[model samples]
Target: MDKAKHFERSQDTAHDQACDPGRRALLTRAAAMSAASAMLGAGGWTALPAWAADTAKPAAAGEAAVRQGVWRDQKRLRDVPWRLRLPAGEKPVALVVFSHGLGGSLDGGTEWAQAWADAGIATLHLQHAGSDRAIWSGGLAAVKAAASAEQLIDRGHDVQFAVEQLLQLQKSGDAAWARVRPDALGMSGHSFGAQTTLAVAGRDFQMRSAPDLSESRFKAFAAFSPSAGHFPGGIKGITRPMLCLTGSLDGNPLGQERDGRYRRAVYDTLPAGAKALLWLEGADHMTFGGGGERGAGFGQRLLGRERDGAPEKLAAHHAAVIKTITTDWWRWRLLEDEGAIARLKAPKGLNADDEWLQG
Candidate 1:
């Protein structure tokens, strides 16, 4: 099937869901609250079981522990949902907080999270309600509206609030939170979430909506499919290390920037410090967004698969390269592993067409 045709049919299916009264009633209220909460300030904490997961296992050599929960801020009436993935063992490890793109949920970065966990790093995937998969229950208009500037600002606050909650949880002796090294932290995102990552990194994108939404806690950053054209000021306020991942075919779905090369502006404009760019030959936008063993989620379904007809081996190859490079990044930057730095400089796994640069 043609990619455009498949995406149109998927959008039609999504629009059809808007007609379901029950689904409409539930998600509408939640999305509305998410928008409202973005404007309000912070508040108290309320905990709720967000999802069902496998048994919480101790950190073994090859396994990771998964836990899910919703952390609510009463003052803003914002319900921030999250999923935590920890490496095997009880030792403290570096933590990376992941933000999903528009129409994505906490389940968005499953592949990346699992890889990071298996590599002995902890990950927390955050879902911004107003812009998450909930908006899909509405329609194309709703999805577009959910990506407003207001939600972008709200997402930064959500990251800050979530980190605050994590700190409190650590102080209170939560097992998973306790294993995270607060001093060693990183931030990452995909697409719109990439914009959020930049926001948290102190790139206000020349917007004054929220005086300064930058949080100084994150030590390093990574952005997948980051739009360098969207924001004018390039790497002005971001002094921390950043890794940018984009593919030759990673075009913008919203038509803001048609060519994938435009995405390279993110790496191009950097001021030359601890920054790196990984340009894959055939990977598409959805390729960087999850889709592990469990398969594609809303991102892949909405944007079409990166490996629609290409060789299946190529998809596996891309996945392997991504996981290896990203895990090495977290280790080198967050864990201060010297050997990881060497691997990052040369980057062992890459096809002839793939390019990896470091400065």
Candidate 2:
């Protein structure tokens, strides 16, 4: 199949699952399970037997300070909805702007954002106008149509514009905005949002006459389930530190490249400086989206359970490992913490079969 057509079909499937009420309910249950499994007390979160219990501390004041708003780019006539999650304090912290997948909204990536905030990092979740949940409202045709190259470029613009706006807000002395470390900004996303992250991180989409969409402000990147087919221009200009997170079962559902290992191209094609790849053994695409083992429901429903039931413990372990490694990445790249860098060199909370490679 043509890569573009395959990408479109893949996105269509993503939209279908993301919009499914059953999937949504399952995701919610999975999230609740993740939270419940991690929170043992005020001391710290529950870690896998391989990791210490104090590996992840609770959020400051028991929760993050969330601020929500809509910012309009008058030049492009674009309205970007954003949600900022800050650690519960006035100190300046590293900020990572998160982009959601197709048909996703600012509500996406909350699990990662919350974990980062708890670890004293901030997240700015951006919702692009042309490719958000609004597409699902128009039905499957609109959903499929929303997965366009133009929309992909627009998402990059959304990230740039949102970051620019954040800089301006910081200059304006907004207390919450002031807490963001402008010099330590990072970019991250899941699925199509992962494509957006790479675009801003310097990957090109081979768009004709397209101005450079890569934003130099992002110091590092963390892409979850990034699409290799969406950006055929490959890793020409991307040179910053990046961490690719994917799963062994993280396959393209509606495309020819059904094997999840294909997603590793994003990590494999990079120039190899300050780059890392975390390949979870049993995690699927939605696992990075916060569904854990339940995220593999599509395959489970199709091929029957792996053992007559989901391994709830493994699900929690995946969530814990993601939070642990990603939080450490932010600390290392954004905060320049030597301890974090050391931890990333040999991260804990992984099963024996998981792969953590860096170069």
Candidate 3:
């Protein structure tokens, strides 16, 4: 099937969902509150279950553990607009690029980037021109309709272009992204950004049976809220250590596929070793990406009404868990942190809020 045809059908399916009044009617006030209750635990501060593999007392402590003992600064590349998350003190051991989901910006990736910086690693939060939040200045409708096959292809080009510029800057002794270990590079993204990461990691769409756009420079990968069943031929050449994160509520609300399980296909299809998946019980799609209003509001759009999310305090806890997991994965994959390996491997120390699977 031609990718253009696939994209047209996808848009039609999504637009159909938007036009269905029956679906909108089902998302009443009662349903909104129920959905909120299902997502948010007691007092709206949804408490996390005791992690069997992680004995960390509170989510804040774990957040602190990942955020502590590291000095960092955020800088902007002159023309690129890429957010540079450079750890203070010594040179970084590795570099990681974080691409935000469709209609997302650099801020969406700040939490994870900070966690990586805290671990003494560098992170680049790439901002895309055509697909970022600028497209949503009107409202959610634009966001849903903003993505196109051309924009999708451009997203991948953006990643490759940013990597080249960064490497060239380092070579010129800019000292910002200097000392980044070429062997330990990492790539991560959320939602549409995950699609971008997949392209850079060697998932060949074979659009018209075209060539793949895998960037060998990326040695490790991570994704949040990635839609499955889109990439044909699966991940043909991706073999790097990978971490796929999602919540029980994560899925396509506008499309027919609403189950979170569908999102796991990437993890299921990746080559065996060094691959891991973290499923946060009761977590909605927005939780993994930590979208302030966008994350919370997308749920409302999904349900066809305006519904608030878990309490602010409770939501923050979930975001913290996401940060901890990403930082730990990067640690093990890029810097060879033994503690991260122990944490990732600890079968007995599981958090009640998080269900982990490894392959």
Candidate 4:
């Protein structure tokens, strides 16, 4: 099936759940909180205050709910924006730090973080100044002009810095942060951010020198629509379980091919027993974000482009599905939720789908 048709069918299958008024409300609320938290004050825009331990609540209807707010990354250059969501409870099973693609921000994939939050996991969406697409395009001309390897190195530091700050917050008994199991920490990102995740997870992307892994953290990693330009020499020496997700409709055909080649290279090189690749059919790079016609249209407008039709709708549907799968994957890997894993690994088996499993 063509991309448009495939997305339409996926939309039809997901329509009921995705359009639920409650779910939509939840997403809106999360978005609003994220925005509000960002604008509250210097601290609000920069970093999250200690979470109140007593503020935890249980998920309504057994669904994980997101807590929208900002977190301060002291290491962030110029205090970038951040969004965090956590399951309503005192005990968080695990923490996942989510990084956005080049030219994207915390808002790019807030819903994905919400899904993880709803699944009883805590998620942090960090917006890095040097690597964010907006910053790259509008503010940091020099960094934007840097070689792809340098860009990856810069982004990798952003991820590493964010993780370090979070760890510090956890160690400092911040009330806003529910103590997370350090060993269960996971990292995920899209495009450039994806490559950063790999670099931070003890993998050398050949973009720059390998980061010091002994001080490196994160038990698992997920990369969505990752760019492979930085992987000139391929990923090597990654022992952590990794998950790489992609879409059939990702633009920049060259980037997509490179992403796939490096992903396979890393997967093939990794020792057996702890890695997976999921390629969603009829989906594009934007699918991992807000995959609705409206959201896609808005994204295009932000990029100063004219609006299109089927592509927008298809993109939105892809976003919803990606959100679902992301939650499932993190739940399985970090929370040890076997049921979610089974669902994620199982095929929907409908037309226009692609998924591969390797060791």
Best by TM-score: 1
Q: Which wins on lDDT, candidate 3 or candidate 4? A: 3
Q: Model 3 segments beyond 4 Å from truth?
A: 1-80, 138-141, 208-211, 230-232, 256-258, 291-314, 347-349
Q: Candidate 2's residue-wise lDDT over 165-185, tens digit each?
A: 788778777677888888999
C-alpha lDDT of candidate 4 relative to the true structure = 0.54
Tell me the TM-score of model 2.
0.78
Per-residue lDDT of 117-148 in model 1, one digit per residue for the tens?
88899998898888887777776567766655
Assess the local accuracy of residue 328 in candidate 4 as a C-alpha lDDT between 0 and 100: 74
Q: Is candidate 1 or candidate 4 better by TM-score?
A: 1
Per residue, candidate 4 scores C-alpha lDDT tens digits across 1-359 of 33222211111100001112222333343455456546654452244455322233445865554444344443232354555566666775688887776566666566666667766778777766654544434433332332233344445655665666677667887655545777778988765566567667665422222234222567788876554332223354666778877655554321223123433344555557787776656555556543211222233345554433434666555555666776777778787888877886664542355666647
Q: lDDT (CA) for every model shown?
A: 0.70, 0.70, 0.60, 0.54
Scanning candidate 3 in windows of ten residues, the lowest lDDT window is 68-77
lDDT of 3 by residue, 1-359 (tens): 55534333221111122211222222342354456556654342221122112222222422322111111111111122466666656454688888887667767666677677777778777767667768667566665655554455546666765676666656666445466677788998877777677667776554343333478888789987665454434563467777888766665645555446767777887778778888876665566665532532353465585322542335666767777778888888887889988987763334586688898
